[model samples]
Target: MKTNFDFLMPSVNFFGPGVIEKIGDRAKMLNMKKPLIVTDAFLEKVENGPVAQTLTSLEAAGVDYVVFNGVEPNPKVRNIQAAKKLYLESGCDSIITVGGGSAHDTGKGTGIILTNGDDITTLAGIETLENPLPPLMAVNTTAGTGSELTRHCVITNEETHLKFVVVSWRNIPLVSFNDPLLMLDVPAKLTAATGMDAFVQAIEPYVSTNRNPITDGQCLQAIKLIEGSLREAVANGHNVEARTAMVEAEMLAGMAFNNADLGYVHAMAHQLGGQYDAPHGVCCALLLPVVEEFNIISDPERFKELAVAMGENVDGLSTRDAAELAIKAMRQMADDVGIPRSIKAIGAKPEDFELMAENALKDGNAFSNPRKATKAQIVELFQKAYDAE
Candidate 1:
């Protein structure tokens, strides 16, 4: 075990059924007068959606706000620029992001550009920001991604078809809200994908090169929660208990990954998301077992521990055998929750594997993968995911 490491999380987090009602008061406490609410068009369009509910709360609290509903599923650099423009024009003093990872990522990019005065793409690597950002709050509408609590933001470069990860403690939201009520309306497929995304977040970090005791404990707890609650949350979106557990699991996973970093699964998934415009969580789900199978050779004991954390029965099994069981258990969970069986099933083409694999090796998260992979190995991994059924 390493002697030193750091763990990061948002300063304040509110979790429960109706904790979103506190957003207005929280904004006031931050001295934010006219915050920009960043979100996606779907939320803005849906009747009585999460964004609508947030707006109602802000109104009741008498907190002036403006809406920027231009975020996309893979959140492009253009989205950040557009939101930043709106924030400046609206005279917004702060930001409140209301959605999943995409919305929060867009808000983070907007804050970066607003503070650093450059194109968002200029700050796309570890600890790149030199200026402190304006106050920002995250109102999570999904029990996945946990972008609300993390210091990392992923933004796609629309022109280049590449996803860039920006990591900085400065990007952490000033406050975060996880209200299960906001997650009740998510569609089943999305709920399944996102829940699996959270699961991968926990597993990857548990076996990451940067894994420490603190993150191990968090990842274990997250894996247990996901194992116990993800299927129920996906199958019955209105189940508050399941939703709350999933939310907590996601947040715990976020804290683990935020400090311990991630692995090739996230690295490869980001490429698919940028290239195919695929859902991030679905990409994570399809690639997770494949990546972990490759990774198990590096630390079978840790993988075996992960199997135990994921609630797999590995009685009388060798370490390597139990490690393999972890991948099998994850695959079964994905199947039970309706995640697509393969990358090919989710619109990924084998012809693009070389390019994506090249980019995957360059991704920031790739640095912490339990296994150090060559470009050829990454390409083989992509082919394996593509050919799996």
Candidate 2:
């Protein structure tokens, strides 16, 4: 039996070693007169950084812009509201977001409600947005998440302590940027966490209920890229070729998961990040192999493919053993990248696992998991993550 799948990405994307320098004229061609630049403060202060380089290029090309550097990790309602206020005040008409998934998502969220109305909460969940959002651009700094080219924007609801995913084709950026040059100064720990995030995204989609051959192919290729290049990227941030390869892998993985839909690992990780204010990639790292290990029994052959993609040798092993090896490979990769093994070590409480599990079931991404999980099963998975230390 075969199932159908649809794939999607941004309208236009620039991916290579130095594509960030190409954005100025691209924005101009779209008639963007005033582009609101959204991102966190950390990168904005470094005049020698990518964001500043973008500004300089825009200035040289006579592109008008304003900077709103207030977006935070797990972007909040307040963050969007503040950016929206600044957007209106600045008389900006387009948006240029430079950073990881959070920056891109925050830019999309703000553009949506500002052009439509206030009360960002009404846009939560899937495909609930009515009107189209404003024109946007995404320049990614991490080799993971790949949010720059996707239509999904994950924002946190501060009041309820749950993550809200606002998804619509309108939220997709007009131009997605992938410049490995921006990746040079990224810390080793972040490099590993983000790299693993891409690996999980690729792995989740390949085994998803919604997966089709097109998506599975994309995901499998991405898996191979992450497995081969992540360690080199982490060990030597200055390695240009390694960083470029990672960006390519991350872009493909993003395309895979955004349309194919993610699964339990993302569902559980989202809850952890929203609840604990944890790093999104770090949460994904700790829970990914645990979920996949539980799922191997359902289709050990497919799991064997995952192991092979993770750079494991399955030539002589049985399917079941190959799957087990895949899990071990994933764990070792995380450890090598300095990702903490336990959620408890990162401030997650054991008692909260039940609530996190309950919310995970409601996540849009969880519905596509290869293995159907009961609430109790999800709870157990959470317990495993909690006790991993």
Candidate 3:
């Protein structure tokens, strides 16, 4: 363990039902008279959706705002530029993002460009942002991704078909909302994918080389929460208890990974997202077990712990055997949630594995992986995931 580490999160967080109704008051408290609302077309268009709820609150509080509903899946650089242009043109003084990772990331990237005065791609590395962002509030619409509470902004380069992450304390939102009510409308498939995303986030951090005591507690609890609620949440999105557990789980996973960092699952999954335009959560679900199979030898003891958190019966099993059970649990959870078993099912081509592996090795998250993998090994991992049953 390191001698010291920092725990980071938004200054203010709201959880549970009816918390979203407080957005207007929170925005007013922040002196946000005029703000830019960043979101996707779906959120903006849906009646009585999170965006509509936010607007209602803002209107009641006498706050004026302009909406930018151009965020696409795997938010691209141009989305940031466009949102920035709107923020400038409308004289908006703050930002409120509504939706999952894509919308939140678009808002974060816009904040970066507004203050830093450059393309988002130029600020892709860790702590590269210099200026403090304008007042920002994240009104989360999904219980997945946990973008509402993270300092990481992942934006895709449309030209190169690569997703790049910008990590900075300044990127963290000033406020966050996690009302499970917002997630009640999500489809089962998406619920499964995002839940698995949270599962991967928790597991990756638990075994990270940078793991610490604080993050360890958060990761294990998050794992337990995900294991207990993900299936029920996916099976019945309207179940308030399950939805609440999942949102809390995702937030905890976000907090842990934000501090402890992640490993190969995210590094490789990001490549799949950029390469095939695949859903980030599904990509993560597909790669989680495959990557960990290569990494378990580095710390079978940790894997055994993970198996327990995942509710596996490791009684009387050796460390290595229990570690293998963790992988089995991961696969079972994903399969139960309807996630495909192989990357090839999502249109991944074996021919592209080499290039994707090279890019995966260069991803920032790769640095904290428990096992150091060469490019050839990463390629083999890709091939294995593709060929997995």
Highest TM-score: which candidate?
3
User: What lDDT score goes with residue 254 in model 2?
Assistant: 91
> Which is better, 1 or 3, measured by TM-score?
3
- Candidate 2 on 191-289: residue-level lDDT in tens? 998999998988888888777788888998998888788999999999998898899899989998888888899999999999999889999999988
Window of ten residues with lowest summed lDDT in model 1: 1-10
Best by lDDT: 3
Q: Give the C-alpha lDDT of model 2.
A: 0.88
TM-score of 1: 0.98
Which ranges of candidate 3 are over 4 A from the true structure? none
What is the per-residue lDDT of model 3 for residues 284-315, given as tens digits with 9 covering 90 to 100?
A: 99999999999999999999999999899999
The sequence of per-residue lDDT tens digits that candidate 1 reaches over residues 1-389 is 44598778999999888898898888888988999999988899888878888888889888999999999999998898888888888899999999999999999999999988768777888999999888999999988898999999899999999999999999999899999888998999989988988999999889888989999899999999999999999889999899989999999999999999999999999999999999999999999999999999998998899888878899999999999999999899999998877788768888899999999999999999988989999999999998888
Error of 3 at 339 (Å): 0.2
* Model 3 CA lDDT for position 156: 95
The positional error of residue 130 in candidate 1, measured at the CA in angstroms, is: 0.2
Supply every candidate's count of residue pairs whose N, Cα or C atoms clash at under 3 angstroms: 0, 0, 0
